[model samples]
Target: MIWSSSRPQLGFKRVAVVLLVAPIVALAPLDPVQAQQIPSSSVNAAELISSLKETTLQSGLTVAATTVRTVETTTNLNLRSSPSSSSKKLAVMPKGTELSVSATHAGWSQVRYGGKTGWASNDYLRTVAKAIRAGELGKTTAELKLRQNANTVSKVLTTVPKAGIFTVKRISGGFAQIIRRGKTGWVQSKYLSTVAQKPGREIYIDQKYTSNRAGLTDIYWTRVSGGDLRESVNGKILIGDIPRNSVVYRDLKLEKTAGSVSGWIFVHTQGMTGWMKTSQMSRKSTATTKPSKYTAKQVLAQTNGKVPEKMLAAIAWDPEKTLIASPALKDLNRLNAAFKKKFGKNIDIDLAYRTRATQDAYWIKLGPYVAARPGTSNHGWGTAIDMPETYDYSFRGKYFKWLKANSKNYNWVHRKILEEESPYAEAWHFDYVGR
Candidate 1:
């Protein structure tokens, strides 16, 4: 009972229904709106990913060229064959999609994505910056207003205090959009400083902080009468005073680990050399020609290798910031000064203090023979120091010979058990024998 179009029994009403559908399929005009127009769509996280297998667009917006770098598409954007709005579409690149930008023109960028090359709206392309596992960590240089949008005229959400640390979600133009304390907003990028934050380790980042590495050339001064520069361990062997208005320089290595956890700094002052309280030190000079009242600050004393971190100091001049017992650090400075004089370079330290947790990790990864037993090694006490396992530090190396002969004067000794003739010989191992 199928009806044919040429059948004489065909009704006028059925023919009229067919005529109505023909115009929509055959005569409808192509889509007229171009997608490249700016400020058209607000940011939408829901549309973050697009995977449109594209049919060639007959026409769309014209993209001239630009952004010769890796950028992310901020929204669902059309990838057109040419730069014009009427150009053919090559693909529908999803939001959050990365594109290799080649050239841009008239608010359009030539981009490559998903094995297809086409033009996309420059409005959706955002420049990329360095990324970290925790995202880009940054600190505000000054108290700033967090704006709802990237522009200064946008609504202010909150006032970010100076030195506030936050996660930078993305950077747009001169502004960086960040999330802090559960609120997200955009702020001037110029007032933001990127920081390298370590996981599982406490990093001391003050306003004076720069990065993970500070240079020895950095200046320091005494802010108070402070403590006597004896050692972090056994406060009895006083070397000198870090009196108020004294100038000093970091001892030994040229580069120091920035934001190190230790509260003691190994410093060398004219005619005085020892460990000082980092809390009483200032990176800025407070000394002036004008006389002012000075007050003495009491130094808190701690005992031996079992002391807390406040009693331990890092050789901040070293990039590794070798940690040691405060007393050992005082002796280390003396040894380093002499070694530097002879070799024109500071001694290289490879290993230093270790938390019990770290010791356990080493014991497992390196084996019992290679690594010190967990919780048993004097490294946990911060009294033991290990030299770099390099040719210069080897038993027969001149640096080793010079150190073996001279280090005793500084109360540091290479034990006989670690000698070349011993079964567990380690020319790099040295113990601090000072009280």
Candidate 2:
């Protein structure tokens, strides 16, 4: 949700209620025994002691300024006895119910309603401004058009109900951009009041991932024979190398698709600050370094040289009578040459560098489990080759053995991971690591 990052915690004390409809009536004098409790040396000794205690309590306690806010949850939010879901629920606050927050916790807010106090989930609380001047508050005088733009000709996004309090941010001619519902929008300035307003409480936005333990702990360094650091999850940009035996932080802020848990994460090493793939990191901090010469640029150079300028691809071709096509030009050609030396026939292809449109079609047809989203697949990058869908049975015996033994020389490697671990798990699937 779009919101401020965090709201400062506030505290408020219970306030006594009083009515002013009747004339003042003095109370009877205290009982003789009650008055006798005071020391003879100090006529107001009891009162003085009570006053000192109250002063100490007030000094030690923090009082939050009175501010109003509203509930923005689609459904009513439960008000609990404590700041946790397990706490006994005291009430339910409905959507648009304006209330005053007395305090705030990590994900909960304490509020008093209907003469009772309870904690509510801060996830649904949207701060509202009261009347004030300067960075002050204003109330809508009438139903005013909240436009998408500053001008009256702009589309009316919604209507601000009469007497609705808003935090005015800026004024452009007749329209004002106000903060409401944890978001900023435009409203008419004439319909808002500049009367003195109560102090507004701060409310923070939730930007963290759903995973609770995300980014909390660091994965210890182990023998690092990891992978490449990418600019983003499944992105092509290579920022730095995540050496073996280094600290790697695992967090949920990175994108996590169903097939891959490895997402781009923040890494600070060798004075560089960029993101890297999580697969390249381990929990162990020390191990013998075995650097692989394989690099993405090497493959890019070969593919780019084969394709036209401004193109990030190579022509996908079918080597044999097989219906499958492959985008890895040099590697595919080498594999076919080696195959001819062993089985005297070409290896068939099942798929290759699919266009964005084609990939989207597969994503729609096969779903996320069976297909990678468009632009994120290695096939689209021209680095992966899928053998015939039935290559497991088609390339049997001698052909299979030769491929297993010789494919590595051409930089092809089969991945062994759970279907949930990677996008797909096909025995015929091979990626060109490097020569």
Which candidate leads the pack in TM-score?
Answer: 1
Please report how far candidate 1 places residue 124 from its true position, in Å. 70
Question: What lDDT does candidate 2 reach at residue 385?
Answer: 61
Best by lDDT: 1
**For model 2, how does the per-residue alpha-carbon lDDT over 100-121 read when each residue is reduced to its tens digit?**
7776554456787546798666
Q: What TM-score should be assigned to candidate 2?
A: 0.27
Candidate 2, superposed: residue stretches over 4 Å from native: 1-328, 391-398, 418-423
Q: On residues 1-435, what C-alpha lDDT tens digit does candidate 1 reach at each position? A: 000111122211212223333433333121222245333454322222211111233234344333346677666566777655556866565555666678765556677755677777665678664332123446677999999999999999989888665556678887888765556888888777655431111112242322222334545766675345543433543333333544555654421432223776666542224466677777755433221121101111332223354445667445445556655776788899999999999888755655554454445433543466666666666677777554577676788889899999998889897666342456777877776
What TM-score would you give candidate 1 relative to the actual structure? 0.32
